[model samples]
Target: MPRILAVDVYQVAMPLKYPWRTAYGEDHTIETILLRLETSEGIGWGESSPLPQPHYVEQWSAAAFLCLQQCLVPAVLGRSFGSPEELQQAMAFVKGNTFAKAALDLAWWDAAARAQQKPLYQLLGGTREQVPVGADFGVMDHPEELLPLVEEAVAQGFPRVKLKFRPGWDLPVVQAVRQRFPELVLHIDCNAGYTLRDAELFEQLDRFRLAMFEQPLGYDDLWEHAQLQRRVQTPVCLDESVRSLHLARQALALGSCRWINIKPGRVGGLTVAREVLQLAAEHGVPCWVGGMLESALGARHCVALGTLPGMDYPADIFPSDRFYEEDLGDPPLVLDRDTSGRPVACPLEAPGTGTEPRPDLLRRWTVNHFHAHA
Candidate 1:
């Protein structure tokens, strides 16, 4: 039996020079909750909580982390890595606290993969070696800011760019970027900024030839999205609202959206994420993995899941170097660049999620700390 050695939570802040605006919300900094799980044999890492943004899942908070430290960790200690299903069931008692449960569930998977000396993706039965990636750019103050940003991202080798869209800014921003980079793959994420009244505006968006329009209506309003899907030519993709496999099924059954964005933390963990992906595949609804500015630990998990067979769309899994000043992993997650200047692969060569924390970087960015049992 493997005894749990420790569980530590750290809060880190990454400041963005300019405000990152999106239809769902805006922010000047990214607040991250980093979780480290250690056993007598090895260590595993995970991240829960969004970047203190309103639109993303708000289920995680500092108080929730405290709850994890006090209650969840103790329950998980001394557990064996019998199987993913067994570990998942063992943690099922911590229901109604998905974020906290996600942190623990992800860590357990990481540890199990390490114990077997296998990559996380291998454990998940995915092996395409690579998945297409796209950049999710922040909304700029001026539409003029987009050309240069698009050019810069293109120059840096991003295959596609998804711009943040708000009401007044949506058409102009897409048109400007399209005019400059007519051949580039361009998509839009409304973050649920539009209402039924704005459904006609999507016709205007059709002129720009967007790849997709994401979450144009309220997060929870699957019925509204289904109506919008009927009215619009551009395929609709749901983000925040599809929290569980059941919600995903509801959205698919109603024809709410043609695409779904799977963020593991929001869905509970990779366990639920897999279920969502399986559901999407069964229904023939396309899906892609979404990002939340995660550290290497969390990003690796996304990469592992994104490598599945039906994940045909470009994922938002950019390399850790793009956001982190210093990474948790020694070899840091590398984006395998191709001669065409696009990232072709994200390798998971190391065991587990293939990430280990840098103590020095952890010390500099972590502002708060807490410990839980086991």
Candidate 2:
């Protein structure tokens, strides 16, 4: 039996090239808490990168890390990873701290896959070697400003492009991007920008033949989204509203959303994420993996989940080169391109997530930390 020896948490801040804005808030930097779990014999890592604003979901704070260090880790110190199901069940006793719970869950999955010498995706029932990748661009001041960004992303070979939408900027942005890149796959993410009263705007947006209209109303407004869906021709995709498999089912049952953006941290873990996928499949709605501007640790997990059979839609997992100045692994998560210049999936042949953290980069960005049970 393997005994948990130590748990370490580090706060690392990475700068973004441009400020990222959404209906929730805006940020020029990404601050994340990385979880390091060590057994008597080996180590596994995970990330808890909460969005900067509490609008979508609550932001991850240093206090959260303190809670994990003092409360969560102690409870699991001597626990055994006998089975994923059993491990997850043991975690149920420590509920309400979803972000902290997600870090532990992700580390447990990583440890389990490492113990089995398999990739995380295979452990989660992924069938494909690679999946299509897309880029979710942020909102700009003007629609014309997006043309160059779209052109650059196209040159880098993204199969699909998703634009951020706010009330005043929604229509013109979509129309301009659609007109310029007529054949490019286009999607819009409102980030819960509209309300039931904005039905007229949603009607106008239907003319663009969007790939999907994401989170058009309040994050928790399932009935409102269902109402919006009824009024608009564009298919609806839910992001912020999906906090768990139960919420996902509710949204699906209410006919509020046709697709879901599965973010492992946001939903809980890959274990629960798989449950959401199974639920989506049973209900006949397709799902896609969404990115949270993750470092390689989180990104690798996203790529792994995207390889699931029913997740045949284009993913937001672009190549590591697009976001990171320095990545967290060897043979960094590379984005492969097809003959037609669209981003294709590259399977991980190595064990687990197939990458290791770059200690040098960690040293440069990590601000404060102390080892517990070291």
Candidate 3:
């Protein structure tokens, strides 16, 4: 068995190329907690970056950084684990810090994949070398600026484009996009901003033939969502609502949603994600992976997990440069369009994630760093 030899934590703040405005908040910088676990075999990296604040989940960077240093790191530092599952069992003592746990779990998988000399995707039961991807832009106040983005995405051959919408900004944006690119694969994400009364609006908007309506109501209210699902033609995709395998089971049984958007951070770790994936497959509910606008590390993990058979469509796996001006990965993920004009992301064939972090870039952006020796 390969014993854990060291753990390093880095808290980083990287600026986005353009300001990001969402229902969550308006921000220009992306804050994250990056984790690296070193074993006798090699180095593995992961990210525990929360979505701005506790609004997405209770996990935040400051608390996650603290949890990692005080509890999570100590529990798994000296343990001998050959695989991520074993490492997950070793760290089972601490509970509910899924984002914190997932960052480490991801790193362990990367390290384990390296030890086995296989790509992380292969270890995760992935099938394709290249996965089709889509882009999800943030909320725009102007709404006029929305059409061009949709037009650009269509020209670039993207299969799907998700735009964020609030109550006041909803109708026109949907109307404009539909009119401009009638054949485009479009969807709307409200980020849980409406009520049961909004069903009428969805009924009217359904004429445009959107791919889905994402999280239109409250985050945890599955019962109400089931009611809303019956009212609209567009499928309801639960993002913040479905957090675990059990929650997924409940959502399915309740008919709460026709589709689900799975983010590993929201669910805790890949173990639960895999379970949910299997569950989604069992229920015939089409699932897509949601992005937290992760840097290369988190994105790679998302890409790897998205490769599973149940991941039916294009994911929100945009190009790295879409957010960061310069990412830490040496050859940052650059997406290419397939023959059908959809973006294609080939899985890393080299050991681990197959993307190496640039030493200088890591040192430049890192605001805080700590190391623990086993």
Residue 189, model 3, lDDT: 89
Q: Which stretches of candidate 1 lie over 4 Å from their true place?
A: 1-5, 93-96, 155-157
lDDT of each: 0.77, 0.78, 0.82
Q: Tens-digit lDDT track for model 1 on 1-374?
A: 55677888787665554566777677766666777788776777777656664455555456557657766777777666555566567766765556667777788778878978999889888867787788778777788767887898888778789988887777877888898898888899988787888888987788787888888888677998999889888899999888877799899999998899988877778888888888998999879988777777778888888888778788988676676656654557778876666775575777888776678877877778887654
Distance (Å) between predicted and true CA of 166, model 3?
Answer: 1.3
Per residue, candidate 3 scores C-alpha lDDT tens digits across 1-374 of 87889999987777789888766667776777788889888888887677556766566777777888999899887778866678777767877777788878888888888878999999999987778898777887677877778778877888888888786778888888888888888888888888898789999989999999999888778998999999998999999888767789999999989898988777777777888888988899989888777788788888898888888878888688888889876568889767766788877778888776678877887877889998
Clashing pairs in 1: none
RMSD of each candidate relative to the true structure: 2.3, 2.1, 1.7
Candidate ranking (TM-score, best to worst): 3, 2, 1
Cα lDDT of model 2 by residue, 1-374, tens digit: 55678888777776666688877678776776678878765777777666554666654646557667777777787777665556557667765455666777777777767877888788877888778988777877776677998999888878789988886667878888888888888899988878999899889888889989988898767999998889888999998788778898899899998989998877777878888999999999999988777777778878888988778579877566676677654557777777787777666876677766688877887766757783
Clash pairs detected, candidate 3:
157-341
TM-score of each: 0.91, 0.92, 0.95
Better of 2 and 3 by lDDT: 3
Best by lDDT: 3
